[model samples]
Target: MSRSIDINKRTELKRLLLTLDVKAIPLWGKMTPRQMVEHLVDQVQWTNGKKTATCDRPAEEAERARQLMIYTDRDIPRNIFLEDLPDEYLYPDMETAINQLMTELDDFDEYFKKPGRIAIHGGFGPMNYDEWLIWHGKHFGHHLMQFALM
Candidate 1:
């Protein structure tokens, strides 16, 4: 599969963000538009190795989860709340959130280019750049669908 952190994919993600408004409501989830964007920012930070996660399973099980979530074309399970994020990246409006996400996207690109970066996912264990990219894409797509953008 193509890595989801590529320039074209990031552009596509940005394009999707343009469809959202501050007052946009979710179709199937509870996060506000700003909250969803903040959630996405957290995910990107994790993928960029700015944050670390403890393994939630043994290596075998973690690998299985990674393959199922990152390699398959299945939708992420709905209503999953994996972490409690701080309000720092939670902008008060959609426009600001979009800008922060775009900036983080650029940071992710730079981080992914270096060697020996380690991204440790809570459930999926450690991930290389490609695996992290896939997870990030799946994650963003999931939240986008939550707000009826996908």
Candidate 2:
């Protein structure tokens, strides 16, 4: 896994995400496009101080999520999110959802450019800038591939 999520890559992904006519990703289970974008962007906010999550996972479930993502011996699974996501804001239209998501994504891109900020992820524990980037890369990439037009 790459240690950094480049701004250019996020920019390219923004292109893919913006052009998508998709309202939801079917295979990963149903999530309105706004829901999916919101879900991912919240992680950025978690890093940026807009939001925080209690790492309340029990010893067992926490261990499970950790092994699935961090285990060196097995390939990362493509069909599931590392954890549940947020869909708090109900978006009224595709344009609105895409627009907001793009804005948030841009904020994240700019933040990533600075380097060295500590990221306090919801389930992943505290990470330096580099590790945070890898987590988002996998997460956002997963949804991008899922939501690509069929």
Candidate 3:
């Protein structure tokens, strides 16, 4: 599946996010617009090493999943539930959640500017910056599509 928006394009991302509001309903999945944005914020924090997570899968399996997810053009499947994440929205409003997501994205970019920086993904073991970028692109693209914004 091809991405409808490139997550690396911060300007475009902010523009698209501006169109999303509290009343917006997801085309698929249970998340409200606010919840989804907050989810993205959490993900960006984790990817940037601002938050930590232990690998849930065996090392070998995590590596294989990481390889497939990062190297392939396939889109993340719809309706995949993450039990570790909160079901309720963290922020009081959509605007705040979106702003936090953007801020986290900026931190993610800055954190990865140094060479050899690595972060631990909950299901992907250890990943370098480029791998995390691919994961975030796919992940953010997935949710954007879920809200029919991409």
Q: Using lDDT, give the best candidate's number.
A: 3
lDDT of 1 by residue, 65-86 (tens): 8888888886777877666645
TM-score of each: 0.84, 0.64, 0.91
lDDT, candidate 3, residue 42?
Answer: 83
Candidate 2, residues 1-150, lDDT tens digits: the string is: 422224336456666667776555456556766667667666567755466556666756755665565442333355555665553674666567666666666666566566565555556555555555556666666566556632
- Give lDDT per model, in order: 0.74, 0.58, 0.84
Model 3 accuracy (lDDT, Cα): 0.84
What TM value does model 3 have? 0.91
The residue-by-residue lDDT of candidate 3 on 1-150, one tens digit each, is 647356789888988888987788888888877778888898889877689878989999999998888888877888999755576677877778888888899899899888888889988899988788788888888988898887
Q: How many backbone collisions does model 1 have?
A: 0
Candidate 3 deviant stretches above 4 angstroms: 84-88
Clashing residue pairs found in predicted model 3: none
The runs of at least 3 residues in candidate 2 whose Cα sits more than 4 Å from the true structure, single-residue gaps closed, are 1-8, 57-89, 109-116
- The better-scoring model by lDDT among 1 and 3 is 3
After best superposition, candidate 3 residue 13: deviation in angstroms?
Answer: 0.3
Q: Cα miss at 99, model 2 (Å)?
A: 3.4
